[model samples]
Target: MRQLLQDLFDKRVNQFVSDKRSKKLFFPKAETKQACLANRSAEIVKVKAAGKIIEESVEDEFQTIKYQAHYQYLIKQNGILYMEEEMEDRLAKFYKNALVMDEEIRPILESENDPETELNHLDLEDHTERLSYAYDRLKAVQYAERWWNSYNPAYKKFQNDCTNFISQCLKAGGAPMRGYPKRDAGWWLQSNNWSYSWAVAHSLRLYLSNSKIGLRAKEVSSPDLLKLGDVICYDFEGDGRFNHNTLVTGKDANGMPLVNAHTYNSRMRYWAYEDSSAYTPNIKYKFYSIIDE
Candidate 1:
């Protein structure tokens, strides 16, 4: 398993530094990564990967294994270099200790954005007492970078964790939580209980749109207008049901947002997500500037 992963990362590093790509290897992801880097005039100076087996089973001479591969990249742009990390979940099959098939397990998200089918109500108990909140962008971005590739022990880790992770970033920025005990109401997470807005991509989008009190946001016209700690919701299929969310952690040399997200566990990635496996021609995005007063 270690050698297999080593070979995989070796191919990835070669592809990043070489102009000629091997068709035998799965190069779509590599192509995307390179394109995103090129757009910033950046190149990967070094790459390293390590794998950890999550599960394994052996039947006769055939084996199936689930593992996670962590990739660290040293990227150089302009005159500076920095590190970025990503984690991918993979399933591999081996026959008599020879690797056969290795495939990435993409995230499968649920649809919770349709107003005709899903709940779109915000049950705020207090309408007159508006809380004074100040959003700390630095703290939010720091939290995002700190936990981009890992899960916090204090929160319940969900299979679809994009929104839950973004909610945590917002909370770290001092966003007050309200509307507890109701699943369809304000943005909040209390112990094992949480509002849909606190964890669902679509629900959080709606909450940010309708929220006028604590922890609210303003819908921005463009991604460039968003500052650090802002949120970007993704409707991968452009079908109105949001499936993913990310936090703005940094900006490229061109000033485009470099986001961090869970689920795929990416850091310092381009906000457009055009190279994403789930990306489609009809993808849609909603940019929200976090409101702090």
Candidate 2:
């Protein structure tokens, strides 16, 4: 009887676990679904005395306001700074009466009468390379498809795994790692340790834009213009502050790019993530092409 039960369990495991398993996830339990939709708030040291409203726009059913705060904030792990983003906040005021949606009351934030704080310049080196990107699109796409469900053992898993997974895909495409023992800059992965760009979506965006070599990008207008290995930055709240990233892995019969990302653990998913919990009526997106020469 024990042998019979063991045989049944082994058969189930074999049927469930595979390198080509479906990336389309479906969690029936409420608790299981909540785990995939959690968003990490900023780790700010000193919040702004008064946030300056930099930009504001109203979409079909929601209003988005981009505010820059005066503060010092950094995401540091083990006393080393990984990434320091601009202290900013985006407010998405939803008009509940506009559409038939769930009940959500996003509190509006108010700024004080103080002026915007000054920022100091840090002496950072700038490295420029005239070389072209040699990252193989086929390899990155393959790696993404293979490991989208089951993670590779070589990399470190984080609470937010989307950017980290993308970094692995980029490395599989022959993007060399840089920076060791320090987490302030460079997209490096050594001894299972990785830089901020390898894990943080916002930091990866900055690194790709500012990189001199290895990886670089140019912003495009829409996802339809993106190539096989391009990236799409998701501003689920329609704010300028992007919070999620996905890689283009496949295209459908209509030629729309199907993307893959982690955290929610999706593979070859739809590019327009209207199903995301953070998605708002005023959601915005930025498309970038990872330039290869």
Candidate 3:
């Protein structure tokens, strides 16, 4: 098992260093990485992989192993070098000490749907009070850096945690939360209950677009318009239902955003997400600049 994993890790590093997309039947991630690198005028100058077997079981001469493969890519773009990292959960099966099956375990985002009835109940007059507050961008980015790969025990962790994680970052920045006790009305989380906008990507996208009071944002025309501590929402299928959200933590050499996210926990990653397994040719994005007043 050790030798098999070593060989596989070697191949993974070679694939990135050569800038050739993996031809392995189940390797869509490698293909996506190469495609994204090309789109960004980036190349992998070096690559490294570290693997750990997290679980192992055996039955009837067959051994099944669940492992994590963490990769670090030294990418060069516009004459600057940036290190991007990601981790993958993978499963492998071996029979009679020979490798048989190997595949990535992809995460499923929670279902995408809205409660229209709840939206209708929201008080439109709520916006008449434009409560002013200061946004602490530095603290927000600090929180993102501290918890990108881990869950905060103070909040309820969701199966699809991207939006919930982004909400935490916004709250850390002093974005006021209101319309609590109503799941669809505003952006808030309290006592085991959370507004849809606080935990759902699609709902948060709508709230940022339409809200005029607390925790409001302005939709930007492009990703480049986003600043540190801003938010980006993704509709990977481009079918109008958003499924993922990220918080900007840094900028690349070309001034494009580098973001941090949970669910598929990542940090300082290129914002485009062209390399995401969920990415599609029709992927749509909404860039939002958090309003601070």
Candidate 4:
């Protein structure tokens, strides 16, 4: 069944990606098109001259072949969760390649420009809770290890483990899991089942963004503002589709946050992931400063 689901997911995602890539030739912004051509004029001319091909066709062919190879490589390395990362890698690669045009790539990084969805926010910013509350970083770190190493031995394991791992860390730092049994409700982990926010990355993003009472978060503008016990959610595409989560465990001397996560079983990994196929030029991130009581 697991194999079946994985195969189905791969098929659906490959089609979805192919569809998105087919629409990649348009430049969403005039400035983006000019800047890209100015930077890679030589390659653009070469591709245009090579087969007397239309610029968009040359760019399209390059992107399609490059992206397919990248996806295959990701599956070879990270077999389990390569779908989101594959698109991310392809996005970053698209911008760096000279064979592609600015308009062809910038649309992927383009935003909807809607204020409500794009704004960074702090819940209960003027609340009286700030003075009296503090996160137990020690407990949070300790609990992170328990989840990583299964020291607790009781919390249920998950197929999609990233969000589950982050939730355990939050509970350690004192985030209350108010809803139980109701999957659509707010974050909670029952014995064998859990809330959507406890196990799904997109759902958790919404839960924290809209949270009003039990546990809320302040969305920091950058990962550099995040400290130990803070949370970072990943949207592989520049669009609002979040697919992964990690907990901050430590920082480098350069003040870069080192993260710990489950699904891939990483410990103290660098927070800015540029090498993975899961990174995109339009890669959007949510850095959450958890409020603990």
Query: Each model's C-alpha lDDT?
Result: 0.83, 0.56, 0.82, 0.54
TM-score (all chains, Cα) for each model: 0.90, 0.57, 0.89, 0.54
- What are the clashing pairs of model 4? 27-103, 85-277, 85-278, 88-279, 89-277
Poorly placed runs, candidate 3 (over 4 Å): 19-28, 111-125
lDDT of 3 by residue, 126-231 (tens): 5577867888899999999999878989988877788999999999999988886767787888887888888888888888888888888999999899989999
Error of 3 at 269 (Å): 1.8
Residue 102 shift from truth in candidate 4, angstroms: 34
| lDDT tens readout by residue for model 1, 1-293 | 56665676576667765663545435456677777787779888887778898988889988888889888888888877777778888888888777788788887776332233565555645477898888999999999988998899999888788999999999999999988787777778887788888888888988888888898889999989999999999999999978899999988766778899998699987799886788999999999998888
Give the per-residue lDDT digits (tens) of candidate 2, residues 121-200. 11112465444458798899999888875678877766566787888888888777765555646777777566666676
How are the candidates ranked when ordered by TM-score, highest leading?
1, 3, 2, 4
> Can you write out model 4's per-residue Cα lDDT over 1-293, one digit (the tens) per residue?
22322332344334422322244423232123223323423111110100111222124425322111112211111122121111111121232233232211211211121122432332222333323345687788878856653435667766566777888888888776665566666568877777667777777787777776676788989888887888888887777768788888876545667677765555655576544345779888889887666
Candidate 1: give the clashing pairs: none
C-alpha displacement of 99 in model 3, angstroms? 2.9
List ranges where model 2 is wrong by over 4 Å. Answer: 1-125, 129-133
Off by over 4 Å in 4: 1-134, 149-152
For candidate 4, report its TM-score: 0.54
RMSD of every prediction = 2.7, 18.9, 2.7, 14.3
Question: Whose TM-score is higher: candidate 2's or candidate 4's?
Answer: 2
Error of 3 at 181 (Å): 1.3
